[model samples]
Target: MKRIFKLRSELVFSAAISAIIAIIFAIILKEFILGSFLNNSKNTTEYVHDDVIAAIEYQLKNMNINDSNKVQKYMDKENSMLYLISIVHKDGKVIASNNKEIKSIDANEVVDGKKTFKFLNDNRKNLVKITRCDYLKDGCYLYYIYVGYGKLENENIVGIMTGIIFIIIFFLIIWKRISYISEIKSTVRSIAKGNLYERVPLKYKNELRELSEDINYMTSEMEKEDKKRSEFLTNISHDLRTPLTTILGYINMIKNGKYVSKDELNSYVDIMNKKSLYLKNILDDFFQYSKLSSKDIVLEKQKIELNELARQIVQEEEDEFIKNNLTLSINLMQEFIYIYVDPNLFLRAVNNLLSNALKYSKHNTSVEFNISKEKYNNKFYAIISASNIPEEPITDDEIENFFERLYKKDLSRQKEGSGLGLSIVKDIIKLHSGFVKTYKENNRLFFKIYMDIKF
Candidate 1:
């Protein structure tokens, strides 16, 4: 709610600033530029007034025409704007006005010291000026000019209406856009509150639209990563607790003298030892995974004979096969296949595959460890395939899941192993810019390693 309020505040602030600027600009146009044009029009009209006054005075003095009709016609012939000319007596009597529609005013309006050259009435309905004739005095005749301008009034009405319409539209758009920003703020707040499934819908375009897309993508990835972390913690607690519980139970029984004989006590000790070993192995694998997961992991690389490494790993794991009553068979190309690799990391991956082959290989069946070289994409790679006929039925999905952390093909964990082995193998191979593949061929599950051979 606070975030929404903040967004609204910012939006309103920006809009207010824009509105103020627009008003200032409009006021400048109205007060300075447009006002100056109106003043210029008024000045030109006054010039016409002076010319008419001069002509009338000339007629009264030289032509000596006392007839008001002749004087009105004389002013009309010289006036192109058709201004209303009125001749009046000083005691407030109008002699001649061209149109009665023109607003009336006192004859003293244009007298030298009296409110000279102003509008006739309070409503600004007419521009009027009165002049006293000097040629005929005996209660002197007063001449008045009244200009009723419709164009200026119409322009003012149009300007006022346009300003009102512009203000209404600007505020309407601001209201709509502020509502959209509030929607974004609410979505972000939901995600922060752990509602990971919430998503933003695309409504409008611009930088804000692109920002929404980027935010959605980030949250989606964060959700997946958070889920993985939760699962890892759950698995770790269970895996670590099971072994510790077994060791604790056996220690308690031995301390309480629960073993009936020497053999029973010896068996209890053996079981405790195995449980402790299991706990240690789990911790060690987790530590290795944590180390490799860091971005700063650097491998110590060297050139090694790929065939020798594979043969050596097989020899090392021969005892595990013997314990399980499974045989180990190797098929090598007999060529010196030297490749550059981090020997320690490579051996760990090789050991994982060999151990997995022995663990699932059926008794009285043979697990094949083969090493050969292949060329693809104009580069040579040392290919190692560990093939075994498994004791259990493995599907395509299980093969895919094998490399996922804590995934157990045999949920019972009878193999006495953590599920991180194959996943660690995958991470190590990927770090070395290599690839791994698992497939079924000829009723055999084969794990293949493709490592680039340095020229």
Candidate 2:
């Protein structure tokens, strides 16, 4: 049989899978959040810078280059970011200027554009803006604004830490699951090695734990079957060997002329004949058991008077009942109890039950036999019971298991039987779409057969 696959890689793989997904999610979320904030920051900063640039443009358009003092003072006051402005006329005249020198022009390099670069590897920056004067027709002004920032790095670190924490927790849970799974594997391995007693002891419950419980139950049933098989072999060996040995000894004596008298020779032949018959009975039990135990065993169905068959069987065994010092009493319905069944197999089953009842019945005690009809769940049945008043009272537990092959009890008819009688009885009835049950009631041990009566 192919073994069941119970180990799950999904728990371990799910952690790694989800971590990858979480990391991707964090990156996307961080960029979105910070990108929006940076965009808002740019908008706010540009709003103020536009106003300052416009104010400078207005001052240059109306004010003359000669009154540089008023223009410089107004530019200094209007620039909110502390912009340093320097202007050089077309004749190289220092017309309107601030700061120590005209910035980025010692080499007489034409300053034509804005230059923004971070200082000290930090997001803080120096932003330089140069604009030509439309009003002066001579010089251009340079605006230098230094912008400082420090918080973006901290937010990136925070986002990464949040993702890492989530991954760590997920991995820990997966590790715990793996540990339990390994324990279950070990227990399963032990069971495979024929240690049916081992069990997986989970402190808590999960899917694997439930599977463990099922495995434990399977192991218990296997143990029972193994025990029964061993007992069956032992019983079969003893029953076969004893009779064969007796027959062999008698045949050897007759062959060797050890029995000189004709009477002695006849006695030896009779004894051998009886042993041969006994061996035949044992073999028959084995054959019938083998055939009946099959799941696909077929029955020859017929409508038969069930109570009439019961009466005939009782009459046939009447001599043996008397020999055993036991009496038989029957209660049967006057109306016919008809059942659909295999007639020959059903007769064997009934005979097995009678033999069992008589064998264990107390000497001079009455064995009660009954045939009746019953209706249950809209289904009709022919109910037959053969009960023996056992020498010792049979308990409910003993009665329940007595139908099992080779089942043993204290009154213990098992050792005397080939042990297939009751088992054969059970299988035969079940093949007829009926059930056999054993019960103890009113101080009598009963073997109750319920055969379905289909119209």
Whole-model Cα lDDT per candidate?
0.71, 0.70
lDDT (10s digit) by residue, model 2, range 1-455: 43333345556566677777677767776667555545445543455346555566656767675576876775555444345455554333444555545434432333444333332333422222322222233355444443443224535564676678667767776777777779888988998998878887853444676777787888888889888898889877888888889888888888888977999999998988887887887789999998877777777878998778878988898888989899888899988768888889999999889988876788899888899887767877789989888877676677678778876564333435677789899988878778987877787787889987655
User: What is candidate 1's lDDT per residue for 207-321, written digit by digit as tens?
Assistant: 5566778879988987987887887787777788888898999999999999889999999999999888878878878877888898688899999987788778877888878
The Cα RMSD of model 2 versus the native structure comes to: 11.3
Pairs of residues clashing in candidate 1: none
Q: Where in model 1 is the C-alpha error above 4 Å?
A: 1-182, 202-221, 260-262, 412-415
Q: Model 2 off-target regions past 4 Å?
A: 1-168, 375-380, 410-415
Q: Which 10 successive residues of model 2 have the least lDDT summed?
A: 124-133
